[model samples]
Target: MISAKFRVQLPEGIWVADTSRAFPDATFRLLSGLRIGEKAVELGEVIADDPQAIIDRPQSSIDGWELLEATDERALTKYETTDIELYEFVESSALTVEFPVVVRDGWYEFDLTGTRDDLERFGDALDEAGQPYELQSIVGTTDPESLLTDRQRELLDAALQAGYFEVPRDCTLAELAETLGVDKSTASTVLRTGEAKLVAWFLTGPKQN
Candidate 1:
């Protein structure tokens, strides 16, 4: 199977037109979900760089979504919708994908492993449904290892070469930062975020379809 990554505009993406308009800085990270009879409930995290007063009114700030929990960095919420094509796309395509899917700014970015025919089929389905989408990109495969950003990849490569991940730890964070020409904190964040994404990549599953 081939792996492809692309961003498409989906009208079925309810979050963008709904809550994001209120707070442009907040991004909804879908974790998992369940069905309550006819309605559905999604449990996910909301990261807001400019949190503003949204957290204070979590109970009512979001429209369709119901805030079930909150923390300093993110908020957990539940909402109901009947968009089966979307939830199904997480697994339904001949492609294999992980969730919660990345959706924001009026688009859904999909990273999936499948064949070209599979992508065409999915796109055709979208056309038939009258849901217009922009195909952003297509690549040959995906994995936990392919998720790293350039800076993160550079730092990881440097760290590995210097034995930073080794038990004895050949290099310090400062040394790695210096090697990459970045500050300690910058290097730390790149490595940390990259590591976290890799961990999440490994642990990804339990789709709430």
Candidate 2:
């Protein structure tokens, strides 16, 4: 299985998008949702200073909206909407959506898990529909260690432990080589080759063969 992360700019005039843009400081989480005939019903939570004001405001694309609960900084709501294009696409593609679709800065960010083919098809469909989206990453479920040799894994672990990969690196190439008792050239070659393999596996998948 593969898990793909996506960030989609919600179309203008949608309630959630408009509200999020209006209150950029607030966070809106679409916890769960389902389609009911031509309408889509969703349950969500809003984290804001004035949740009641948001609940009272009028919005487009919504047939019904109700605030189920509210506190000083949070609100729970149930709403039914007519803007179902994105919802329909997700349902028809047979991909499983992770909950709590985050809404901020007029964008909906979420993860969808499925086979590679299904995810590719879904992305294509979104493009055909002219929806604006960004594919952040596609991560395979397989363990990354399975793709590396024992030596590669050992070097990587040592590098990590020595803070070689840190923002302000604590260990230099010479130090790393000394720790492994290897010549500088051999250590550099092994580290570079291993890094390339890991990058390839992350962007695509494990090499076949």
Candidate 3:
């Protein structure tokens, strides 16, 4: 499979309002979102230096949206529900991909993996939906690191977000295991091996080492 990343500018909505004000720097991992009647229901979290602001700050949607629920932590997991029109647009568009979509600075950034045809279809979908997007990066061939597998990527990504690499380590090995519903040893191995492979891949960079 091939991978690509893009930046999408959604139409005016709550996300636009919130990104402009309350959490300009907040990073989002959208877990689930869809249109429910005249409004959109979004379930996601803010991953940043300060996550509490996301939960406590008041939201403003020029169009229309309602913050149904939010908590101080676990913003990604807990049902931080909201009504957002952007969610509807995203769900209906070709730009939709499997990877968790990241919203920050009022733009949607995401990585997608598929064949060339799939990517072409994605572009077509965006065009059909009238959603303009900027292609940030594209990988046409198989990534050697694709060997890491989907589960490994998810585990490593979660660990990284949980501050597993911090000096004090915000999350313990056991905590990571609990998050992934796996045993401590399994989590430890996933973190260790994932880090090693990712670092080696980065050191190798564009040219095959």
Can you give the TM-score per candidate against the true fold? 0.51, 0.63, 0.52
lDDT of 3: 0.61
Rank the candidate models, highest TM-score first. 2, 3, 1
Off by over 4 Å in 3: 31-43, 48-50, 59-77, 80-96, 142-176, 179-209
Give per-residue CA lDDT, model 3, range 37-149, as digits (tens): 66644445566666666655555532333344445543443332354555555455433433356777767786665556667777787888787799999765436567366
Model 1 is weakest, by summed lDDT over 10 consecutive residues, at 54-63
Off by over 4 Å in 1: 12-16, 34-37, 49-69, 78-85, 88-97, 141-209
Candidate 1's TM-score reads: 0.51
User: What C-alpha lDDT do the candidate models reach, one value each?
Assistant: 0.61, 0.78, 0.61
What TM-score, to 2 decimals, does candidate 3 have?
0.52
Residue 21, candidate 2: how far off, in angstroms?
A: 1.3
Model 3 residue 78 CA deviation in Å: 2.0
Model 1 residue 18 CA deviation (Å) reads 1.8
What are the per-residue Cα lDDT tens digits for candidate 1 across 27-68? Answer: 766555554454445555568864435545433223376667
